[model samples]
Target: MLSICLIFFYILLIISLTLFYFSMFFMFNDLVLFIEWDLVSLNSSSLVMTILLDWMSLLFMSFVLFISCMVILYSDEYMYGDLYMNRFIMLVLMFVLSMMLLIISPNLISILLGWDGLGLVSYCLVIYYQNVKSYNAGMLTALSNRIGDVALLMAIAWMLNYGSWNYVFYLESMKGHFEMQFISWMIVLAAMTKSAQIPFSSWLPAAMAAPTPVSALVHSSTLVTAGVYLLIRFNNLFINTNLSKLLLLFSVLTMFMAGLGANFEYDLKKIIALSTLSQLGLMMSILSLGYPNLAFFHLLTHALFKALLFMCAGSIIHNMKNNQDIRGMGAITLSMPLTTSCMNVANLALCGMPFLAGFYSKDLILEMISLDFLNILIYFLYFLSTGLTVCYTFRLIYFSMSGLSNSMSLNSISDEYYIMLKGMMGLLFLAIMGGSMLSWLIMVTPMMICLPFYMKMMALLVSIIGGYMGYEIFKYKLSWELFLLKNYFLSNFIGSMWFMPYLSTVGMNYYILNMSYKIIKTIDQGWNEYFGGQSIFYYSKNISLLNQMIQNNDLKVHFYLFVIFIILILMLMLI
Candidate 1:
């Protein structure tokens, strides 16, 4: 069974690679294939099943498939003895298919089909552990994503006014059309939920309860990026609108909040999840700034390193006896040298080290931000978030890999999982070289960034300072007293994601849950009791007694009832 799964992934990987190359060619030639099958048609209106084969969709599909192939390969070793391995593999394949459906469809209705598929499959995968924590996480994830699904449904309904559901044909003309702005708002709101921005942000970190492979595919490319991709497709429509500005605000805040939260986070997977959130905010902010192309570039580059990062984290966690706290893991490089090496590469790439996969796209994005005519506050937040990203990356590195040993003196920890290593090695190569290759391919004309020397060096400067701060901040992890005494409240505020999980979960639900409770008490247990079940029971009992009397030939009682009925009829007739 494992061999069959591996073979299946390998074939898909090869086909995806071929498609990617073909997409590059098609993109260079400015080619597109739009195939539409009309499912329903009326006077001047049509509902169609549309497949849009273009460079963007095909390229993204390639990345998703490649990462999925790698993740499944890694999972064989990570999930080796799990009884439900087959079920796990099937769920992942379904996720990939849904993502593909989302990628190629230009019709909103079909997009919703793909969108709902992602939500349902993700919930299943999140609860794969079948524990209380997993169940809660899965519900949070599903309900959060369902918001986006609803938005899509609304968008579909609104698009009915246009007499077509194919958004590809309408995105440009819809610009400046005030009446259609509702659809734009709906799309942005939907994207925000899927990407986990602001109030929706809590679910991303909470979703870490899922297995690491699911996290790798979800946080990296498929589930979370779905919204960003949708925005990219519709970017032209929302440009310069109030919706765009609002999106910019929320996205920047999300970036800052996630970066700050990662610094104080100890759970390895959650830290990485927060990092994914921060990166997502960056992509969204860029898209909001009307540079969907740059956002797409960062998206592709980010998928590679982020997926690699998760895989390495999974390998480390596995060797640590499933312990995920970085404090319990120190000097991991001494034993699992290869895995840690890959992790370090991923971290540096995330920090935007020059010539790495992240540097090409990230450096360009920072430079582009400097060139844009944004306010000082936006500028400050962007740089601050960049620094915090480095801070958390280093903090994670210090406690987990380079710091002193904190585990048991005698424990088995080594990079002996050859299958897992094989998977990491594939992504390690891409995380190193993908950025430059993608830059060469994606940008036909070189983006000449002109900025002063200091401004150009801002990203590097912030990263250096952030790395130093990361080491200093967490230097005394073993000493709880000093750390807690100095900055408990401050750290707690920032570390808890600014209490977003509370606001989104308990805060939002408190009123609604209370109302539901009142409804149950007043209806289900109150009015319903009298008018529903008990009334029926009483009437049925009396009717049965009457029938029994009639069957027993109770002549006196029957005579009295008949005389009363006849007298009533005669009195009515006389009146």
Candidate 2:
């Protein structure tokens, strides 16, 4: 059945990709194919299930199906021994299907269906391993997303003021209405949760408890980009608003924080997760700055390479007996040359190396932002975050690729790399060329970027320093020990994801769970016990005693009871 499903998805992928490119070259106006099933109509408004098609949604859907197809094929080996292998493949397919629904919906009510499907399906995937760690991570991911889900519902209710469930129709006309301000705020909040921006961030790293294929598909590419895609679709509504400016401010902070966290991270998978978070921040910040297309370009290019990066990481982890700590790995360059080469290419592309997939979008985003009307602070954060990306990528490359061999003697670099590399080879080509190809296809006219020599070289200069710092910190083992020892408190805080996991789980649970316990005790033990069970027991006991007296066998007792009953009846008759 799984193989049959895989064959089906492959056919769909080919069709979607072919259509996406064909539309890219030929379709001029927005090509929309909508199906409206009028389930209900109230107060002159209609609710619909709409499938909207433009070049963007088609392109995104194609990428999602491509990654999912590769992930399913890769799972043939990655999940080889699993008892419920069929279930895992189904869950991945369901996740992709949900993302497809999300990408196409133009109606807010219909979008919520897709949105909630994403949350529910993601929770199932996160707990696929069903261990203590996976359980906690799943709960964290679910609860954090519920916040956004609720926000979307509220936004839908607010949209009633416009008399239509379809927000696409009114985005341009309703941009200036004060009553609709809350809708904008709520949408941004929902995007934050989905994108794993800032406070919603720790979940992304924690979600590494799932299999690497899931981490590649859900975390690196499709799921995280859902929020950015939504924002891009609704970008026109955010113009000239204080909320967008606030989003701009905080998203940059998130970008900086993610970069700093990735530098301190040692887990191979979590570092990639952090990089995903950082790129999300970059996309969100760019979207808030009114350049949705640039962000979109980056989103697509990042997905290509990041997914490949995870496949390579999964290949490494699988061969290393599932040990994810980078410190425990080294000298695999001699053993797994192909996987190492792919990993290095991904790391370089992520660093925005010249002409790679990441370069085409990332470089343009930075150069364009420099021309925007902004203060010096933002100007610096943008370039510094870019540098931090290079720093961590270099750090990751050095330790995981070229550092000392510290693995246990039992660890063997397996030669069974055929299936895994097969899955990655498709994305590997795109990660190298997708950026330039998409840039030309998507952007009709190019911007003539004019900047001072120093400004032009800013990203390069910081990236170089960051790379040096990464090499030194890992090359000199003493530096790692010294930094942690001296900066114990601060290091721990950052290393622990700024203590967000503790706060979101235990810290939150302490009071809320305690309150829940009290409520249970009050209802189940106190009020219900006294008023329900105890009272029923006493009343039943008294009734049994009265019946016993009335049925006594003694003649005198029976005669006395009968006389009293007759006297009471006679008094009632007299009255």
Best by lDDT: 1
Q: What are the per-model numbers of colliding residue pairs?
A: 0, 0
Cα lDDT of model 1 by residue, 224-254, tens digit: 9999999999898888878888999999999
Candidate 2 lDDT tens digits, 1-575: 55644574577568667867856744466466656777788997766566777778878887887878787777777788788988888888788888888988898887888889989988999999889999989999999999899999999999989877778888887778875677888888999999988777778888888889999998655678889998998888786678788888878988888898888888999999999988989999999989998998899899989999999999999999888999888888978898888888888889998888998999899988877898888888988888889989988888777856778886679556687788888788988998899888888687789999988887778888888888877787677879888999998887777787788888888989899899889988888988999889999999999888878788998789799999999999999
Candidate 1 regions exceeding 4 Å error are 38-47, 478-481, 485-487, 514-575
The list of candidate 2 runs beyond 4 A from truth reads 1-9, 25-47, 512-575
Highest TM-score among the candidates is held by which one? 1
Alpha-carbon lDDT of model 2: 0.85
Clashing pairs in 1: none
All candidates' lDDT scores?
0.91, 0.85
